[model samples]
Target: MPIIGMCIDLVAPSLPAIGQSFSVAASVAKSVISLYLLGFAFGNFLSGFLIDSYGRQKIIRLSLLGFIVASLMPIYLHSITWLLFARILQGLTIGAVSVTLRSICADVLPPERLTKLGPWFGTMWGIGPVIGPVIGGYLQVYFGWQAGFYFFAIITLIAFIVVFIVVPETHFNRHPLRIVSIKNNITEILKNHVFIGITALMGLSYALMILFNVSGPFLIQTTLHYSPIFFGHIALYLGVVFVLATFLGRYLLKAHTVEKIWLIAINVSLLVGIIAVIVSYFFKDSVILTTLITALMFISCGVVFPISLGKGLSLFRHIAGTATAVMYLVNISISSIVAYFAGFVDMTSLVPLAWMYLFLVFVIAILYWTVLRKS
Candidate 1:
């Protein structure tokens, strides 16, 4: 599921081609990135509602179906606007895939196993982005950008079949769907500070992540004039670092709980931020240095994602669908909005956005100690 979480990241390199096809400005191309995030936010919530109203398995089926179809069909549409429309649909389906997968993980994994399995989820997460761009870049360079979509479509088709055949119904409650219960259920979960704060943290963390993710291709390929394949390799390097960090985080968590791990994430994120800012100042023009800085920033994400998510949503097992969807939506929405605003900047300079990420974490840390220490 986390691998699928990466489908868009893989598509990042194709943004320039998309711009040329659409005849829009580079910043406008960035909105192709933003529109997807917006769709993700909306779809996350919609996915939850579907799960509540229908069932988890059914919703999963629907999302995968749409994902595969959208991937296959949208490439033929030439206008960037039309492509953006397709990407939006892709994001929507992917949201369902993420929300349902997380809800299931929250359901199936016991607290004991969650500690170990938590990081594996992050590990899988780290793995996805690594491959997404490498594959996307190859498709774009050798075949053209349209091949990227077809590639994802084929992957989705396979996943859809596997999911349908093996995934079980997880609702536990066999009762007919009740809209009021689903609505009230969301309200109940939101009332909890632990839930809101942790989820809010996910939002902010992802916002930082998307800023880097969305900007990477431009920063690497356009600014540095690296080949798409070369930038993809850089992404691969970053993913390798992230995968190792996630495993290390999981191993450490054998001796720690979610709170302790979150603190670790905070400390690492601070370092990552400081390093990123310094790198942006000194080596923003050097693709290698910038990649390393960005990769380091993502190292903390592997830790933050699982800890915050597992800790935040654990108490809401009864409303896992609504809770998980809401969480994913908010997380991506904040990131997307931040990234959209980032398009305002000259791509040549990455300091403002990097500093913004650093500041968000610094504030979150201070608040954690002062108010939400228990978090």
Candidate 2:
């Protein structure tokens, strides 16, 4: 899960430097993120089937090894094309690792236990976003862009060793490799209105974060003339707000239903989004204002993400791996599309980001009213 955060946020601070190194435009460089997410989406599909067929341990171990190898590619390759390929490979492996781990949690932990621990899990994953940029920023400043990849390889290697030594095979009821069964499982999962709705909400929540990550570097660095290190500190602040909000969400869950918590958080998010738009229009260069508004939005996302993920996964315990994969597939695919298109948006001002945030929140509200709320 943290790997997912590291995959994006760790590389984000170096986007400008990467573009300069490749002699490409910022828009072209942003494809590194979009393409990696596309590969992640596809990886989910693959892992869903493979994990169900072969079991979690085998797939995750292989995926971790693949990620380590992929992390090394960008170090030796200088071309943007090769870098994109490496990112795609990294996404595929990390996506598989994420799905496998989620499936393992669903397999081993009862729903009540899973719900109880959701915030802690969220905190762990949230740590990546909190620290990735801080480390990447310094790496970009001192060791160059390649240093980030080197760091990735070293850390993942350690993780692979840990997993190989400690994690056991948890999936006892393995399905055979049958395409028809796979299709049926997917169809059944998709047909559950509540599951689908929660998953859609999860996708939207994740997309909001992705939108910021994809656009923030350029807005802060090029438009506001801030250094990557400063941008990293801002990201660290937002990440802390998100982590704290997750704990607040956990406390709220003791008294409120998941749907109620989601409603409250999202409505607050819509209000924050509106404020962001208004503020951006009036004070375009105010980095502090923009960061504050963005932090509020992150709070909304932090509250929604873990609860929704746990609720969605709980609905399909029998097909936990596939369900996890589908959830992330929808989640990352939305983000990938948003990230790709965000490159074309005017990054010279914060208004575009503000508008995008509001638009996404509106869509989320509508989805809740028509889909989740009714269901």
Candidate 3:
């Protein structure tokens, strides 16, 4: 999980440096993130068919090998074009590992144990995002942008070794490889309105995090003239809040219910959105205000993340592979689209970021109050 998180997130604080190194606009450099997400989405979408056919462990091994090779491409090839291609390839392979592992857990665990896995999965997942940028930022400051990728390569290589030795194949019931079967499975899952709503809500919640990851570098380092290391620290601080919120969300869910937790998240997001609007309108472009507002917003999003994933995954035990793939595809795809467009927004101002969150949260509120209420 950390490897995958590092693959995607470690480059965040270094976006400005990467742009300067490559001599491109922020929007074009942001493509590194956007393209990776699109690749991840496609990979997850495609893995649904392959994992069901080949079994989980084989696919995971192949994917990790691909990931390691891809991570090295940027260093060896030494060009932005090769770097972008490598990122896309990394995303593709990452999708296989992530989606397959989740499916493996779902396959082996009982309902009671599976219910317990959400927070653990979240914590493991959160650790990467929390530490990856801090490490990457320091790496970029002391070393160079390519140093982060080297770190990625080494860490991922170690992870691949660990998985090779310890992890076992979990998919016992292998479905035959057929295009029609894959399409049918996906279509069947899509018909579940509850699943659709939960997935959409999860996607929107995640987009909030991606919004910052994609835009923070330009906003903080480029516009505010902060150092890359400082930007990394900012990410670390918020990441701590996010991880805490995940654990807190799990505890809260044990005491309350999904609807209640989601309701609270919605209200908090709405409140944060209002404050952001007010700040952006008046303060205009205060880095301190923008960072504070975004940090607070992440708390609400953290609460929403695990609960939605647990609920959505709980709904389709029989088709965990397809379900997990679809869920990630929705999330990464939405995040990629949002992050890509965010580059076009006025990075000199905080208003666009605030407005984007407000609009997304409003949509989530409607979904919850209406279709998602019964579910």
Candidate 4:
């Protein structure tokens, strides 16, 4: 799961450098992130059935190997086209691993236990965003953009070895590869309004993060003339806030129903979004104020993501792999589209980004009240 974050955040600080290296606009460089996410969505769609048919271990090992290989492609090729290609490959492989890992958790853990452990899981996953930019920032300043890809290769290699040696197969109830059965299962899951609503909420929450990842560097580094390392530290700070908020969410869940927690979180996010727009409008270049407000919004996401994901996955445990895949596929696909269009938005001020945040939260509210609450 951290691999997914690493794939995105590790290269984030280098986006400008990547653009300079290839003599392109920042928006063109951002295509790397958007295309990676498209590949992730495709991979999830494909891996779900393979995971259900062949089980977890085999797919995990193969995907890790592919990820290692793909991680090395951009280091040697030096072309943005090749970099995008490699990133797609990386996304594809890592996407598979993500679905497989989630399925393994669903296979071994009961729903209550999984929900209880959600904060810990989110913390571990949060590590990538926490460290990726901090490391990437220095690498960009000292070692150049290619260094991030080299780091990716090294870390994925370590992960590959660990999984091969330590992780055991968890999915035992292997379904046969039948087209009709796969279609039916997908149709059934999609037909569940609760699943659809929860996944939409998840997608919208995640898109907020993706929008920032897509636009933050240019806003902070390019617009405000901050150093990549400085931006990295900002990312680190936000990541910490996200991790801490997940624990806060865990504590709240113990005392409240999931519905109540979600409602509180969503409304809080809306309020934060309102604050962000006002602050950005008045103090357009105040990075501190922007980061502070963004952190508040992240607290909402941290609270919502684990609860939504656990609840959504629990609904179709008998087909955990497929459900996980469908859930991530929809969410990441939404995120990818957002990432792509985000590049076109002006970064001269934080107003556009703040507005985007507010609008997304508003939509999340609409989805919840109209769809999720009833379902």
Q: Give the root-mean-square deviation of each candidate in angstroms.
A: 2.2, 1.1, 1.4, 1.1
Tens digit of lDDT per residue, candidate 4, span 127-207?
A: 888898899999999999989888988888899899999989888889999999899999999999999889889888878
Summarize candidate 1's per-residue lDDT along 90-175 as a digit string, tens digits.
88988888788877776677655544565677777667777887887888899988888888888888888899999998766533
Pairs of residues clashing in candidate 3: none
User: Lowest-lDDT window of 10 residues in candidate 3?
Assistant: 111-120
C-alpha lDDT values of all predictions: 0.75, 0.87, 0.84, 0.87
lDDT of 4 at 321: 91
Q: In lDDT terms, how accurate is model 2? A: 0.87
The better-scoring model by TM-score among 2 and 3 is 2
Residue 11 shift from truth in candidate 2, angstroms: 0.6
Residue pairs in collision within model 2: none
Q: Which segments of model 2 are wrong by more than 4 Å?
A: none
Residue-by-residue lDDT tens digits, candidate 3, 123-144: 7788888998899889989998
How high a TM-score does candidate 1 get?
0.92
Model 1 weakest lDDT span, ten residues long: 110-119
Global local distance difference test of model 1:
0.75
What is the number of backbone collisions in each predicted candidate, taken in the order shown? Answer: 3, 0, 0, 0
Cα lDDT over the full model 3: 0.84
Better of 2 and 3 by lDDT: 2
lDDT of 2 by residue, 1-375 (tens): 676677788888999899999899999888888988988988887898899999989999999999999999988877888899999999899889888888899899998877756676677789899998888889999998999999999999999999999999999899998989989999999889898888888888878888878899999988888988988888888888888988988898899989899888888888888888987899888888878878888888888988888788888889998888888888778878888998888688888889999999989989988998888
Give all TM-scores, in the order shown.
Answer: 0.92, 0.98, 0.96, 0.98
Error of 1 at 360 (Å): 3.8
